[model samples]
Target chain A: MHVMIIGAVGMLGKKLASVIAKTRQCNGQSVTRLTLVDIAVAETPENPAFPIESLAFDLSHTDTAPLLTKRRPDIIFHLAAIVSGEAENDFEKGYAINLDGTRHLFEAIRRERDRNGNAADYRPRVVFTSSIAVFGGPYPDTISDTFFRTPQTSYGTQKAIGELLLEDYTRRGFMDGVGLRLPTICIRPGLPNKAASGFFSSILREPLVGQPATLPVEDTVRHWHASPRAAVRFLLHAGTMDSSRLGHRRTLNMPGLSATVAEQVEALRTVAGNDAIALIRREPNPDIAAIIAAWPQDFTADRATDLGFRAERSFEDIIAVHIEDELGATSA
Target chain B: MHVMIIGAVGMLGKKLASVIAKTRQCNGQSVTRLTLVDIAVAETPENPAFPIESLAFDLSHTDTAPLLTKRRPDIIFHLAAIVSGEAENDFEKGYAINLDGTRHLFEAIRRERDRNGNAADYRPRVVFTSSIAVFGGPYPDTISDTFFRTPQTSYGTQKAIGELLLEDYTRRGFMDGVGLRLPTICIRPGLPNKAASGFFSSILREPLVGQPATLPVEDTVRHWHASPRAAVRFLLHAGTMDSSRLGHRRTLNMPGLSATVAEQVEALRTVAGNDAIALIRREPNPDIAAIIAAWPQDFTADRATDLGFRAERSFEDIIAVHIEDELGATSA
Candidate 1:
């Protein structure tokens, strides 16, 4: 099977590409070629057995998706997006990348239906990255699968709209799709300060590397879902899942931790010893607090669970996964 | 109270404007003026007691919403949109008017905060006309308020996206808002053709006025909700409801009928005699039947009902509303 990863140079995209390359196959078939897409040309993931190609064009460019579709990969991992903070800062640019860019990608796949001759199985499987920020303000006791999305930021709203489109387009057979609404990726490897949730991981990743990191919100502030390993696994699982059973609602909220900042700090202390916990600074920025409060605290992913997706068993597992990925496996 | 009715010349727009004119006042003050806006000049409602202003400007044009927001209405009823058929027929036009126009309106109201200093008492109320098309596809037993929107058309997709924006913008305190997902309006008092469902009403409405009317779907077909009177009342009620109880999700599924086409025909026969029913033609359009079947058969509008929004009790009342509105209350 041929594989493509849009935003292949980014964090999860890089991790996922590496994982797929290492495995070399899914269910015993070889990954013949890998098409890596990003604005800054990505370093092609070296698969000892498979061939590779890379492109550095902006996905929003009218011809990008169609050009990619011409290659006709069996699977497409679409992780490309304008981050929340940047999206909030530049309105038109945000909509251009997150909303219009996505539509362009899907339209490209749909146009392939009769390229040769009309066939039932012409479209490739599409895996889209969504986020938990899709659910916002006035959240219930436990965010259920049935909760209607009331996104607070322009970013969240855009993601929610994308989910709707992915579902409808997939239902119409434009593409076989699975949209995973990721939680904030805990202990995100390398650097903090860009994303609003950068501090969450920055506190952990920086400390493990012997550096101090700021905590913008109070320790009691809670938010939702998963580790980077879990996100990659979720994408892979969604790629191979029995989509016929899921029916029309193609997108889903991936499961994750419901712990507050204090709990996260506690978990870090347990996993890396007291020295790591000492590196976090409690600064309490009200702007960040206001933004965080608008996001849903947790979700009961009943549907995704029923569909056979899984997540880390505990914070120790989350930390262990991060340590193995960022540090050497021996460090954990 | 100052009121503005955008899209005042369209079918529903004219009905709503006429209703608002008769409302007299809101919260104890006399309605001082009524502003009507549309892409073309609007029908001036007979409101001799109040001042009236009509503006002919394309909302899809640059800075349209900002221009309208300058009027500073106490309550603004935004009914401007290309209908589903037209939206599906022309993709670019659909997004331009439905998505971009809606955003422009919200952005304009958001700007009002900076210029006016956002007093607690000063924010205008924005009411959006959403549609049942927001809920589509082969449905469940009944579409409850909690059911997720899985719209099929470009129109439905746009409306669903519009609902998300309305919620987010309203939550941020840009302005108070309410979105009403109205059912397919029956007995639409107009010409005899077009709109897949136009035949549902035309089969009776046209025959009453002595014309041949076609039935595109079987008489056994069933779907959901309201008379124009109830729908107009819904807009008014939504504008005045206690939204504090609604939390961040402000959109409501306004109430209506769940009757079958046979039931509709029976209602018509009872009200207009056998001659009206005799003019019906049994010509089915598959494109329309497919679209109509995908629509929800019934909706459990528990939320809207609990919130105090009501609809006509029966199809008989619906027929009465059409005659009264079109032929006058004294015609009987």
Candidate 2:
């Protein structure tokens, strides 16, 4: 099977690539070839078991989608997006990459499928990474599987639009698509970024490394999260799962661990003791607090759970996964 | 107030234009000018009204939106779209006219609003007509305000996307917008068309006019509906209502009456007597039945009701509305 991964340089994309390379298969089929595409060419996964082609291409360019789609990979993992903060800060660029780029890919796939007037042969499984941000606040305590999406931010809006397009395209038989509304990846393996929600990860990731980290909101503030491993697992599951099981709603709210800031801290303390907990400085910024306040704290995620998607049961398990995966250790 | 109607040649658009002309005002502001736009120029309404400009323009064109927005009408009623059947049959044309066309208009408005970045002026009230088609079944008995949009058709998908864009643009302060999810308009005045739902209107309309009409589905099949006059009222209400009152969710499930086809026939019998009902023919088409079966049956419509948008309380009242509006009579 030929598998294509867009946004192959991003953290999750990179991890997913390495895992696929190690496994040498996708959806129970041998990976004959792997295509990695991004704005910058990704480094080839070390000692890959399949022929790997890394391509540097901007999806926002009108020609990029068609060029990439012509190869007709058996499975396409579309993980590219402008992060929420950047999208909000730069509207045009955000829409260009997040909206137009995604649309172009879908349209390109349709065109390729119908290249010959009578030929409707090419149909690939498109696994798109949507986000929990597609929802906004004035949310129920635990958002149900069927809650309406009223995104407060432009990034969220773009993702919501992408979900709609994915469903429509899939329904029209242009592609077999699955949209995973992924929760924020906690214990993200890197230095803290400027995203309002970055603290959710940094506070844990930094402390695990014996470094000081900042906490921007009250301990009572709750948010949804999943480990990077679980997110990648979701992509794999979506890629392999029967499209008929998805029914008419192509998007699924991925199962996640919902915890308050204090719960996250407690989990860290359980894993790394008081020294790591003490490293978290309580310097609350009200602007970030207000932004986080409007975010969804929890979701039922019943549909995904029923469809055999799973997440870490507890925050401690989440921290453990991070340590095992990122630190290459069993314990923090 | 300068009012512009993008689909001024359509049935509801023409009625809205005539009503506005007769009132000589909108939102308590005197009507100074009226701009009617469509694929073909609309005929001018009768005298004693504001200066009227009817323009022939296709919104799908890249330049048309910018040209239309240059004038900056105070209230822009965007009621343009490709019908569901056409959209289903011609996928590319559907996306081109419905999706791209809507995006261009919104983008044009944004550009027009930000022409002078420092000025932060030119925010117009954009009232968009969405539809109940945004919902598909496997539905609840009564779809609530918060039900997720899982559009089964391309046209519905396009409208759902438009709603998302409307909310985002409004939230960003690019424009003040309102999206009304209009129910099926019943007792339509014109001759029966090829639409699957056409019988919902023709059953009553044709019989009332002493002509035979076909009923394609079972009498037990329920559906939501509003009068054309009520649809126009919803538009005007959306255009003039305080933006702040809409809060974060700019789109509304417009108030409508939910009734079974049997109830419609009973209402027709009550109003026009058995002589009119005798003209009804039962055809029982499986194709049309399957199509109607998947449509939304009812809605709570609490939000729109609370917002002061009103609709006919009964199917009889709906028929009365048609009689008064089209037949030039107080009663059937």
DockQ of candidate 2 is 0.91
Candidate 2 local Cα displacement, residue A208, angstroms: 1.6
In CAPRI terms, model 1 is classed as acceptable
For B240-266, candidate 2 gives per-residue lDDT tens digits of: 887798898999999899999999999
- For residues A61-166, write the lDDT of model 1, one tens digit per residue: 8887888888888989999999988877776677778887888888888877657777565678899999887766577868887676767777888899889878
True contacts kept of each: 0.62, 0.97
Model 1: lDDT of residue A22: 84
All candidates' lDDT scores?
A: 0.81, 0.92
Q: Give the B-chain TM-score of model 1.
A: 0.94
Candidate 2 pairs with clashing backbones: none
Q: What is the TM-score of each candidate against the true structure?
A: 0.82, 0.98
